[model samples]
Target: MSNQKDHHYIPQFLLRQWTGEDGRLVRFYKPHATKLMAEWVYPSQVGFEKHLYSTRNPSRRGRNWLENDFLQRVDSMAARSHAKMVQSPVVGLSDAEMSAWSIFVRTLFHRSPSGFKSTQFHSIRIWEETVREIGPRYAQMKGPDDPETIDEYIREGINGAAYDQVLEHFPDTMMSSRVGQFLNNLHHAYLR
Candidate 1:
């Protein structure tokens, strides 16, 4: 596993575009959970959370796989495409460049702190609904050794390995499907 802990929801490359002559971007935030205020800070310092993208389950790719293996690649590709878009016209972009930009934009909507929380919420809701539907069947088949009630079954089952697997894999799977749909529906055109 990598020692990298801090993960940026907003890629530094995107944030650095707003940097001033002082090499720092103006960050507006609610300080102390009160009124909003602005502070000049490095992009790296402002848009990250410790271990935000770290997965509890360690795979062959390592614990930081999502951050290192996935988001980093997305950011890198988008950075190249963004540079091209800035220097030239959008209509001049190649298919790959447009695809990269589209993927990045879609990713940004789901990778932010709020977006991640919402994804987690939906995943849990789906799991809960599945458990409720299956609970009666499971209870009927369960032996004396099994958990007594549906709630007990849920608590034990969901707090174990199954829960980790669902939480870890579902969001990535959902994002992949959404990206696939976005790419399939995307059309290319140039306006005069």
Candidate 2:
């Protein structure tokens, strides 16, 4: 559950499940709401941290071990949040807040020497742009005139089937490069 108490901050799409797929979940909501979620979470920082840890070259059993463990935990948390976003969409942040997060993440990635992690920025950015273009109604059913329960908004977007829509709508080289960098451990970020 989100801590946002203001009703005005909650988007209607977060009230229900939208789409689904096997192995992965799908959530739908208005484009604006999706944009908010995509940019608002600051997913890029996770990538930046990952890149930093990978470059550290930790000793067999030294502080590097602890650092690596911490980075893994952060990565896990980021992955969980992304999965939840697809499994259960919740909109409680305003567009401005989300944009600020994106900007911050972008700045962090840009400045980090381990900019390899910033590769994920393209995927998040594309998702945010798509959400802005899709419109809320196009993604999920409209919520009630007055939302008493925020859970409903979260529930409405969790669809297990619409996962393909993401790939269909947001196929980008940057996403591929990020994935490649994660798998190969080398940074060739010319796509950005």
Best by lDDT: 1
lDDT of 2 at 75: 34
What's the TM-score of each model vs. the native?
A: 0.76, 0.21
Q: Pick the candidate with the highest TM-score.
A: 1
- Write candidate 2's Cα lDDT for 97-143 as tens digits: 33323332333343343343244345445544554454545435444
lDDT of 2: 0.32
RMSD to the hidden true structure, all candidates: 3.8, 23.0
lDDT score for candidate 1 against the true structure:
0.74
Give candidate 1's error at residue 118 in angstroms: 0.8
- At residue 178, what lDDT does model 1 achieve? 65
